[model samples]
Target: MDRKGFSRRQFLQMMASSTAAAIAASAMPLTTLAQDSMSYNEAPMLADLVASGNLPPVQERIPANPRVVTPPEEIGQYGGTLRRAFKGISDRWGPTKLNEEMAIEWDIPDPDTVNVVANYISEWVQNDDATEFTFTLREGLKWSDGHPFTTVDVQFWYDWYYMGDLADRPTPITIAGEPMELEVVDELSWTVRFPAPNPLLPLAIAKLTLGSWAGPTMAAPAHYLSQYIPDLTTDQSLIDAAMEENGVDTWQQLFGDGGTPQGQIAGWWFNPDLPVINAWKSVNHPSNDPWLAERNPYYHAVDPEGNQLPYIDGMTHAWFDDNAVFDLWIAQGEIDAHIRHVASANFTFYKENEAAGDYTVLLWRAAETQAFYPNISHKDPVLREIFNDARFREALSISINRQELNDLVYEGLFEPRQASPVSGSPNYDPEFETRWTEYDPDRANALLDEMGLELVDGVRMRPDGEPLSFTILFQSALAQRGDEVNLVESYWEALGLQVNQELVERTLYQERTDNGDVDVGVWSADRNSVVMADVSRYTAEQADGPWAPLYGAWWANSPRAQEEPPADHPIREIWRLWEATLVEPDEATRNALFKEMLDIHKEHPYMIGTVGEGPVPFIKKNNVGNILGGNIWDDTLRSPGGVASVTWFFRS
Candidate 1:
């Protein structure tokens, strides 16, 4: 990959950032610019074009690519609205945090999540290759006060949210560096450019910039959040020191001191009191009661005949505990459709209410992949050595029966999974499927013996005289379900491994998870796609702050080596190949890489994964056509804020 020597086509078509436009313009042929692919030489050519007077060349450009799929007949319509309700607003809105998860589920549009505002918003980089993207803003898109929504708004989002911290921009903000351009092609149009090639970028752009780890839940209105940037970004060392002096040791205290009552709502809503949510604005709500929404004239999308959307009237959300959502839906039938199903620790109620048809409990499997993490940071040298041992890992792999786990933990509601990431996703490699060891006590015992782990005084001890006892701390809330910890504890006890279980509250659980305090813990890394770049970012060895590097420190220190240098491990080589696929423009090459990654991940047990499931939504009969298969409900679509149940009336 002599990135410098390649011609434009070779550079653009090559595996990675070889065809970068900026690099090309500096040293390549001007005539070869835009040579169909973005190979190394083409980048320089394109850069030359930009550097020359021809930069930002004037033209009335239209998409030469194939048209996007039209919204389904059931989707494109006017008059109807969807009123949804939620338990509460989500937390972080940044990338690699809880807020990101919420946004993925709600704000962004991907292959999953059927209903998404991003889909309606014309994007700058609209296609797969991301060779080009453009956005034409809604004709009269405006804030509640009638200020126009323009390129500035998008630019603000990029500048404040996506510019810094690789962790800050999960999906979009692809160029790994600061934002470059926010060109206003026209009043209603704009062009944003990345420094490098990123085909996976359009989906990233649609997602919230900060805390993307948590999944898509909400988005910050750039209009309002920008107001605080100057103050927040300013040097307040004195204030921070004072806070520390005052015993506010946590970063949250400094970052989240007194501001305003609506401070928390800034990430999801522009002005909570004003109640402007996307295509509609809230009009009325009972004192200390649920809120309502009405159509907004400022909404940009229009029907072919020129009528605005949201044909149906407004809707309401009864803010309550998780169970109340289900109860209200069944009793008063307030839930036209559970746009987002809220679950709590209480499974007993869910089980009882489900059989009675209490609001149609759509017990779809969770879209998250849960796995048991074996921290290589275990202090006991002997135990650590065994964990690092391939035979032990293989033994653990075979010892645990996934079928029994599926039957036990999920109550037979989900399928068994073996892949580390999404089991059935397009990126999942079938060849990498690690089979669960049959429930053979003999084989389990034999593998342990083969590794010289022996039972002494009812506790498994390694050959070096180190006890096999280790604590597995799990979230107490989830522990209560199906007696989860007990099941695991019993299973490991049968394997002659002393498993000490500790169930802690959510806060403590989070702290331990962050500190990597527990030897083994159960968690789910539910991401959009398991690209090496995405995982590498998460597993990087030395991460600072709330986010941990995507890969745990244990896996990178392997002694195994196919290359001359042990550091040049075969696995890392495989990973690099896998990562190259993320930016590949060709679909066939990308698919091949995806397959390879999956196969390799399965073979190397980077992290053992268990299952895959859908985030289910329960809808009422009146809202029959409202639900889309992959739509993860966002707070904006919930009652009192967004289009509410009335958005359903827009059915084509």
Candidate 2:
């Protein structure tokens, strides 16, 4: 299965020698003076140690010129438990990842700008062609466990783990449709080279910086992870030893499983066995109820006055199964601050309960969560064929009067637009919002009939004479949008298409989408927030198969599954345009490519869209400060991007 010329055994023997050389090449010193500029103060829990001259001063524990954070009211007291909750275990890692890994991302003021800012890395130098990039890591930076994190760690993650070890997992290769090369420049620097120019390289690094995941900028410590890697350890017996200790299946499972005690992939999963650089680390990992974590003493960020960031000492997260009772919970006055998952529909109820609960609801225009977007790539074989037809999607798009839909569901507050880039994006085109959007049932009926979906006794019939009707699969988390879904179903049904709706658990819904099992899929997007990271979704060839499983499967592996598009496929140009868009060196040229792709979406209504921009609610305790007050709520600007909850403090 591994085409990389090394089986588990060969790679291990090679690592036995390579790891020997890399061991000393990897040990970075933690007592460096880069942290000398900051003042020091320990948390109240550890205040006695500082008073008694028992522990190292806070200056030595924090980064030099620690990434400064200006809270709403000066700096904050360093102790209070931030309480939060979510519905699922997979969502547990989210709070841990917030504002923790800030590195390598371009600071786009809006989606339009091309200017990039250096954050985690000290410096970055790109070649004229944009194919090669040289980077310098922050000097004297140490992991939470006092491990010296160096360029060698990055090299190990890129060359060995991402490119080599993960035989089945997907990477940039799946997106760019090309391979990449990584080289360690020095103890504190590295280089990444693509076969072709990749202007999106910074975007990739930027995403990695914002997210708490394994990335080139945030590599696993080679010295710490070597014991688990079979190649690095040079002993298969160690694998069994680890399996017996951790109760996992294999070395790969143990090492790649970053959430468990074995793998320390990110700053969020900061365990004693694992090291981190974030402001906080989990105190009780893999926890279901009241999941807890504590502040990282050696945090790389600080308040304006040099106090280490994360004004709060720790956090505790609860879990819930149903969102139907979210408003009930908010009304109960038990929630501290909630803004992530609570929908806008509950704002009225939330406002009625706000005074008693001691919370305030902050409403920001939401671009991603407002609309009903139909995935044209429905999974059922019969429905897939119909949904894939551009005419079918166009008819669905034109039949829905978004204004009426918005008026009915959101009280006419949301913008009646399409699933394209919003105002700020360099790619935003007005035509995308208007094309084929008028309410025209006659035209829709004509299009269906032209596509040979004839009207049989009032309902549209398939080519094989079966009823051309399918249930739109929806996630229960979006129960608030149930009315919107039902409304859209009526419009389609009015066009002699018997449309139905099915509500399922979020987990089950996602699983079905991933497997391409559902009929019509209901979803929405804040297109600007996701444009760079998930551009493939806009095109036919996708690494993530949920949107278009058949095309995704073909793109993921041309050898397996059903089919591939001919050279002249409607979306093949989108695929080619994406390649050029990411690779184009000039900013204007890249933007033009983005515009062209948006135009293609307009020209071919691949995904049906209804209401677009709408208000998404952000409710938090009145005392919570540093809420990043502003009008802008794009992906990177609002809670979507500004989850630096670490910088927040209680006003009291």
Candidate 3:
């Protein structure tokens, strides 16, 4: 599954040729022939802006060492309106203004891989034991607002955000619960000293897919945010004055939707005042209107031939209320390329209409075939005790007919398995995937009987003599999940257990889950990258899920835990392994720790297994070119978009 040894183009072809799911599913081959190369040049729009004295010259705009992207096919001309769409308003709402990438290489072809090299960083120096890591940044780097980026900005974030309580985000890179120390050498260099070896540190800064502190923009620009900081300004009155002037509750909210300033917020691309380091910037708010984004004049990446990156001049994201309206838009060729709501159920629908809409379908491999999962954590103590037992969990897992569920929902295109790494991931181990996944009603009934559950009219009565019944809280975003949940309910019903489904809105679902208001929950489990990036999932890391909610809450809240995890916490072993995995520098030892984590889950799986490893659909309109690969990467991790979007351009 890990195709690290193959060439990028070869890797794409291999994925296209291998999966039977795609052949029966219908998808076109990708074309990535190289185009004639050229040297770096600015976009016509930006050149005109320079002529009008509205922007700086191209030479002044680029970083000291601009990231070089070789043209994937023929060189592209800059100019096009890339149309996109969104469903509704939510947290960090709106379409992506710039791509989700930082200074690094991305594996667009294979989304599961941590596949990357470096971007913003020019050089890296790590101590032998890897306790101290230093990075040399490229000089002359400027944000979109023309603010010089330096190591000072990195320290500013460390001082005000990471060290303080601006955002209580976790530092997964910590070892044995000890935080890393920060040191700055110069304007262009900085060092992170960990208490113990943390090999994942480099992986952390560049990781875009998921896990340990990942994002495209690493350091916030101190020049732009310093005015709002209480300690940064010696004049306390200045901070008070600025806060009063803004009339906002918090500095972060005043920071606006994200780090960028609202006054600088450009059209859909970004606000004009917000200085960014991306190739494109959002110039306007997306709510109540179509979000529009424009090219950043000071973009710091260039094609091998020396052309400025992002051949497209602008992007527009139109919003639709629901999938029905979105589907109509896609059918009529209104959408250039989209896969946000495209599920396995809609693959055929997409295929049937591809020709009419002038777009091609690509069935890329998906890390998750069965997006539906059941969380066992319950607010009720009696139910929690029943769900916590390893045997009960296994018996519950095997009782379901996963094959039927897979066929009914995913059209039998995916492997009937549980939430673990798929075949291609480096961490994947088949044993973990197959354990306790068989459909055996007899075994399930016997296991329940062992737990003193008595059958009465085909429904098992709990130890308390009540009919064994619980609800699986759900959200409507998952297509055909009601049917999927009903199928699950049927399986449990046949096994002399009562299972019910309760559908709720996204907000309510999140709120209820956070407050431990649900008994059982149906949600997608993690893809492999999430496991490696953020080890919180399998270990019941997040506090809000129905998967060991108490443990998760206790771990997440730290000293504020409502109740401490007893020394004999059954799931604590996995957490210990996760801790060891973070500190162990030896790959073999680290992998051993990871393997133990999976094995423990098999013995005491946190969630029920169903279906996984299915193909994903990608649509590319005829006019678009240089996709490099029609990669259907994990949308949650901003897959190919963050990885290879720089190489994509409109056909001339």
Per-model lDDT: 0.42, 0.60, 0.62
Predicted candidate 1 versus true structure: per-residue lDDT over 427-530, tens digit per residue:
54444544443455668678888887887877778787877877766563344343545665677788888888776665576556545455666654344232
TM-score-wise, the better of 1 and 3 is: 3
| Candidate 2: tens digits of C-alpha lDDT, residues 527-599 | 3443654465576333122446556556555322324655666667776777778777787788788768767
Query: If scored against the real structure, what TM-score would every candidate get?
Result: 0.62, 0.85, 0.85
Candidate 3 local lDDT, 1-652, one digit each (tens) = 2212224354334434322222122111212112223334788988898899998877777765776655555677788877777754441222552355454434333332334445655656778777887866666777778888788777776665556544433455456667667788999888878888877665444443211122333366678667766666666675566557657556554544222223221112233455666666766665546777788777767776678888888777776656677677777888776555656666677778888988876555555535333344565767877877666777778877888887887676667987776555555567778878888888888888888888998888878888888887876555346777788888778888787878765667766776667777776664344345555567665543457665676665532223445688766777778778877878788878888877887665777768866666666787887653334344333444544565567776
Candidate 1: stretches off by over 4 Å: 1-120, 123-132, 164-184, 206-223, 231-265, 269-358, 361-370, 377-386, 408-411, 420-424, 462-464, 476-481, 525-575, 611-625, 628-646, 649-652
Question: Which candidate leads the pack in TM-score?
Answer: 3
Regarding lDDT, does 1 or 2 come out ahead?
2
RMSD of each: 14.1, 11.1, 6.5
Model 2, runs deviating above 4 Å: 1-38, 46-55, 92-102, 106-116, 167-178, 209-218, 234-238, 241-248, 255-272, 369-381, 540-546, 556-563, 631-638
Candidate 3 regions with alpha-carbon error over 4 angstroms: 1-39, 91-98, 109-114, 167-169, 208-218, 233-248, 252-272, 369-377, 529-531, 542-546, 558-563, 628-632, 635-637
